[model samples]
Target: MNIKEASSRLGISARAIRFYEEKGLIQPAKQSSNGYRTYTENDIWRLQTIAALREIGMSLQDITHALAEIDQGNQQGLEEYLELQQAVMYAQWVELKRMMDTTQRMMDLNRQDGSLDVSHLHELAGSARRLREARQNWHDRWNYDQQAAIHDQRVQAGKTKEDKPFSLYHNYDEALEQTVQWISPVSGEAGLDIGTGTGNLAGRMLNQSAVMTGMDQSREMLRTCRRKYPQMHVKLGNFLALPFADHSFDFVVSSFAFHHLGPEQQQLALEEIQRVLKASGTSRICLTDLMFTDSAHRDAYSRYAATTGDAEQQRALRERHFPLLGELCNWLGYLGYETKHIRHNELLHTVLAVPRP
Candidate 1:
């Protein structure tokens, strides 16, 4: 039969048959006289098998390799191929089960309050789970020796404020101006700036509040803060595992740092914030990163992020910085913080969440 006849009989498109040929899964019988392609029952069976395997997620390379082995009269090839497909199917089934389990849990959360749906709860659970994992990893990896090495590295980098082309900070400053304008900072007893890079917020709070503490994981960053704002108390710490006691601060704020972490880290940090803030305290987390609308920002941000790290570490470093706003919000809410305000205007996006009073 001709290619068209075989394709019509199989109830598959001619285009798909051509694609299978391109992938080296099936070869049409070549004709010499008019150079017309011919298809036999063997080819039809092969195409059907290929289509079935593809529907079950067999990759092009695997299909092609298996076809070659089968053509070479290797009887075990078909068995091996089936086994590979079975393994993939099992893995997919496992993932589907996990998704269903998560979905069921979400339904329960939503049943408690009809305001949230599946997507919202899924995001929350995923974020919270990831946070626990990251915290566990950090606890396992951190030791006195690692801390000493980090401290030494901080000392070696030296507190030099060179002209680094960081667009994040520039955008952050713009956002901060707009945020402070709309909601005036009502002075509280004390405030904490979690992950206070360069002490920008802490610097602003120094004069405005009774006492302000800048908390960051990087000693180098705290050193920079110490140089610029001697009055504000700076401590090296992680947001996920804050060092302060419960109800330690009246107000907690983080600027453009939450997205650096995955959903898990953000939620853990949120729970930590909830644990530490006063009952009536407020928390504002300012997020200044690429929005869902800003496609160009990722390329620019990625290229610029490369300069901050050595060549060996640039790719991983860039991956760490970029995150979507929706995921960030889902994490915040899942960790039990009420999202009071969310603003995304121009290129800056900010979210403010307060613990339940």
Candidate 2:
């Protein structure tokens, strides 16, 4: 069968089939005179098996290794891999349940006076911070001091029109332009950029004469941001516990950073963003990481990750808990925000949200 036929029969896309081939996961039996690849029944079965493994949350690397073992007739290794995956999935389920319980507790604290108990909210925030700190490994993954030293070089390389290291790093100028356009920073308005790595987003807002303050967990990154933009304020902070008062900014923005956080942390970060924004204020944000819209999409991302050779990045990808777009939208609605998905791509998402009156 041709690629299209295989795709149709398996309920997968032609692009996905090509992706598997690119990863060396499948090989067609022949190439026709027209230069089309042809697959055999065995190939189709192999593809179907791969899709099934992916649906079960197996990473591409894991799937590849398991398949190789299976081809060699080693069923024991496959069983071991499945056991490990089951443990990981169970842990994630527990964490999710904890987050849900926390949310419910917070909701229960709302008084009959239509006001939230400030002290109770603070306690919940502290719980969230603790949960995130326990699960997060970014401090170990990123060497902020080293990254800061080469920050300008990396940014310049990313801006070049030639081959780039990663899609997120490609076309730096274009990405920044799109972020600024989506944010639409107003002159003299106060804005905050969370996880402001090297102040890229903050700098764009500052160019519009907006009062921009940047926050990041890495002190070294904040130092770089300060040296580059002396006029803007840079703070050493994390998303779970923002170092600012309530309703402090007219707008808030973040770019390519939230994926470092766990699902619970993402929710806590959004709450903090909303807290720091003035009533009816907007937040235009971009997330450049894997987003799992469904099981199939999650599997597709795992395959994409297999193509990358960066071990640290691959580990981060494995550890990261991507929040589903629908779940995020629901969270926004529950928090009294009107949310709009500005752009949804395979590995990126842009959203514009405003507090509802």
Candidate 3:
């Protein structure tokens, strides 16, 4: 096969194949009579292997070393090389997850009250440094320490009646009420609240005599929750890996928190929520975040932020990850959830879904 044929058969770009050949990771089998470089079956296999390694996050240098070992028939050396690369990739994943969380927190702070505070910027920098120093492994995408501190501050502010969290949304209370109605928890029915900041929604469910177990990644937030609702069960855990047995809850819900996850992590978290939910159980997610269907919508938001004269809002609008409502519904459906309704406004969205029968 010529380069074009091999590229098509291997599902890689021709330029990528040429670059790999340049790096000595692959080579053409021979030069045809017409002076065209041709690849044999073995060459295609080698290119496929190189592509596979790259997909698994291997660097070019590491892949070259592994390929060299394979050529030398050093099976054990290749295994050791791959194992080392796996460890390095895992460390990088942890750092990237921490950085993602820090960036999300910064965006959230920027969105608050339509202005950025200098002290908040300093706090964000400190949080980034702490995340780097801690180097801890986490199942979810959020940095718990920073999130917990922010939640604690919000809780304190709520107590003082100064700045209520989620107050910016005109329909915040209505959305919460709608989610509760959709879940329709009966007395003694077990419910799980993922990312239950300060146990607000869980407390509301508790009012209906439902058994509420709230989970959050932040210990400080859980502390505040425990103090607020002495009888409610609050645990420190991540949405990606719910620390619960399968089929544990009759219903699951989250409020204004799911958007903290990236698109991939959001799907994983939904899967985890499904795993914990009992058959026929419902999930209501009240999301007070921005969602843009395309770049044009994003540009319009930018203009709106500038017109409003909120520098912080403009930054938040630029940095936040706003998934499309249609895409979110598709993810839920693909995960075997029967999506019931997706209600939205300029600044908020609510998704109601149930486990497929």
Candidate 4:
């Protein structure tokens, strides 16, 4: 096969194959008459091996050394090299996951406030150093730590007070109540809650005998959560990349947290959700947050916010990538989830998504 055919078969770009060739990773047969390279079976196998290693986050130098070991038939050397590379990739995965969380946080900030100020840059710089500290591994844009201190209190308070000009939860307590009600939990079944700040949503399910593990990026929030329920398993994690294994849970749930991610990030979170959910046809995901019914609702909300002259409302409109119900369902459906929309009000929505039988 020529480079084009090999590239097509490998599903990698032609440029990448040429670059690999330049690195001496693989030597293909060259026609004497024209000096054109033609990939043989051995060459294709080497190329495939190189691509696999690279996919696992190997460097070019590392790959070259690994391939050299194989060429020399040094099985012991190749094993050691692979073991070392595995450790390196594991560390890289942790750091990369942290960086991805931080990047999404900044993207969310830029989306919400319409600009990232000098203060934002300073925060980002400080966050790099803070990553060494607990809870700093993932920096939440909304400062959930501060919110964690009073999250439940605020929700309870909203229940009794006059309605605010704008709130992420149309009815805070009601949203949670409905979201928890919608989630059908079987006794002893494993469940995970992403962005499970203070264990509010998971707490209700736990009462029903669901084996719940709550995960959040905020350390302070998790601390409060542990205080509330010392026995429950809790971890510091974000939605973009769930820390659990594939098909680990019977169900996953979250509330008032999904909007923390941008649209693309939301899709990424859903991908993680689908991975962690069991292949059992009954496995499902339940999430509640401020969202639009559709594009028309989003447009009308913008006009309503503008007319109200509430900067907070206007800012909320701009800052929040409030998901559209139809779009979210479409994303869920693409990932093999059948969805049911439960609208709490004009702005708040609960999506109950389950695997299609």
Candidate 5:
């Protein structure tokens, strides 16, 4: 349809549509005969998404970013964008409510006394602004972004007394090699490594001639990964929601990053792994991280931690989401995949999955 038709269909003015195009929000094809712009159904839907986001107070820049994320294979991009906007609106609500409460308190003061004190009102408003500003900023508990630079260095710092946090990283190098070996990379095959911090696991497969794509949640880690393997593909994504199309890779692997997710996210991540792998029977999923042999193993570890009175170890044990080996296998089985557990050590292990017959 022509610009007029699109504007009519969208119930938006042609000028507004032109303005959106000027902001690089949409690109309509030009008719070959008259060079007139034409909009397709996809373009119209894109425009609708933009309009909806703008209605909710998203800046043009924010809308552009959300659209780009969707282009990059985040199928849940709209939901994620809405969640971010919700956070922003919630912050704005706090600021507005704080100001409103201060106004009410000032009104209360006037009701109790003959007149309002301008200086006292100013102080209350200032305090409210400061508190609202402080409450608006959110920080990650792990601080992975800040730690990206030294992530490779601190993996097996070996500074622990006996039991320590992230003991899975203790055999980091060996684990990476074993994971790569387990993958048995074949030339010309497409492979993806999730939570591929600093390209540790992905880089090991360079000589195997397989096309490797590394994905991580931390941008700084991706920067380092790019520096380490310039030819390898690197993407910014998390486990629970992958930024790739369905059935996109021949095999999928991950290293040392899955434990960061909670139980539900872990299960969701498993489904995502299954979704992204190709339909061929030989397609596989391999993962390496800290895991218990089973429920009994987890109980023994908890009991050992308590008996030792090592406060730090106990805290680490409490904080980490170490999966049970049996649970992982069962989840894979339920997902139509056969799973094999490989224990590298008492605390470190790997799990490989292939589609069941």
Candidate 6:
């Protein structure tokens, strides 16, 4: 069978079959008379298997290894490959089930509370938009390599800790003050500090809490946190999926990490935080993230954006460079938390989110 027939039989594009050929995964018999490629039923079977594996989330490298094992007369290897596939499918099924359950619960809550406070409705919608902006701005634009480069450049420049692009250094004193203001400060209960970038707050605030656990997604940050606060507990993990049990924490606080997530994931993290907090638990937000109302910052960041990409990408880049206060208030409201913006001289905004009565 020629390329056309092979593609027709496999229900894939001829270009795709050619791509597989380039990958050395498939080779067709060469016809000398017209220099045409020809395939057989066996080739068709191989293509079908490749397609099936790809559909089931197997990487091309994995499929290539499986094919190599088959060519080596290792038939039993197929069983192992199938077992790996089953494991992947099972994990995906579990994730899908969780998503479905969450969506169903959201729907039920929506139906149960047709009288949603206008403030709450606006808060949720605005928060979703802010979350979308954050993902597009910060986390999506920043790859692992970019993060490393930024870290190295800051080090090479001998930049002061205060000169760091995003730092919680200045927020430590204010954070401690806020903790003291908590209506009923729990001084001896376990707490988890999400996004504990430098552990500055964790170290200072640990004295106020019995057991303080600091978790950050960045290993480099965690390394710094560990060295700075040897007695504190620090782990690397995403805020959206904390590795703790429900009601495991007496208080959960994040120092400037919430804006990195997409809106939905932000809410998911908030919900998870609420779940992990004991009844009447408290959360304090000292968002070091900034948004530029200053024309100089706007101009400087604008030039930075233009050098990178299109206007859309530029604005996204700038958004990551700053945080918005009103948007933060909306996010707190959506999560059913009361918010009060603390007056501060620094660009960072402080808000507190407490469970609704």
Task: Give the number of the best model, judged by TM-score.
Answer: 5
Model 5 per-residue lDDT tens digits across residues 55-162: 999888889989998778775455556655654664465456557878899888778756667888788878776554444332335777788899877765742325
Lowest-sum lDDT 10-residue window in model 1: 139-148
Q: Per-residue lDDT for 122-142 in model 2, tens only?
A: 999798668756555434265
What Cα-based lDDT does every candidate model obtain? Answer: 0.62, 0.72, 0.71, 0.79, 0.79, 0.63
- Quick one: ranking by TM-score, best first? 5, 4, 2, 3, 6, 1
Backbone clashes in each candidate structure, one number apiece?
A: 1, 0, 0, 1, 0, 4
Query: What is residue 30's positional error in candidate 1, in angstroms?
Result: 97
Give the root-mean-square deviation of each candidate in angstroms.
20.0, 21.9, 19.4, 17.4, 15.6, 11.4
Colliding pairs, model 6: 131-263, 290-322, 290-323, 291-323
Candidate 5, residue 221: how far the Cα is off, in Å: 1.2
Task: For residues 1-357, write the lDDT of model 1, one tens digit per residue.
Answer: 987898889988999888877867788888999888899888989988788878878888888877777789875556556555654454344334445777687767878844756677768678646544676554312233344334434423422324533333334455655545433456655778877766766677665654888876654566667778878877656666666666787777776566566555555566677767776645444444434323465567566656675442354344454455555566767766666444444334666665555
Of candidate 2, the 10-residue stretch with the lowest lDDT total is 281-290
Candidate 3 backbone clash number = 0
Clashes of 6: 4
Q: Put down candidate 6 lDDT per residue, 1-357, tens digits, no spaces.
A: 899998888899999899889999988889999989999888999999889888888878888988887888887465446545654554345345455665565565577745745565455556555554533343434453236325434433432334334333345455446644552336776777787766655675676654788876665666666677878987655565565656777677765566666546665566667766776535443333334435575577667657755554455554454445565567678877776666444455556667666
- Scored against the true structure, residue 298 in model 5 reaches a CA lDDT of 91
Residue lDDT tens for model 4, 196-289:
8889888988988999999887767887888998778887668765766678999999987888777766876787788788888888898888
Clashes of 1: 1
Name the TM-score of candidate 2: 0.58
lDDT of 4 at 82: 62
Off by over 4 Å in 6: 1-98, 102-185, 281-288, 291-323
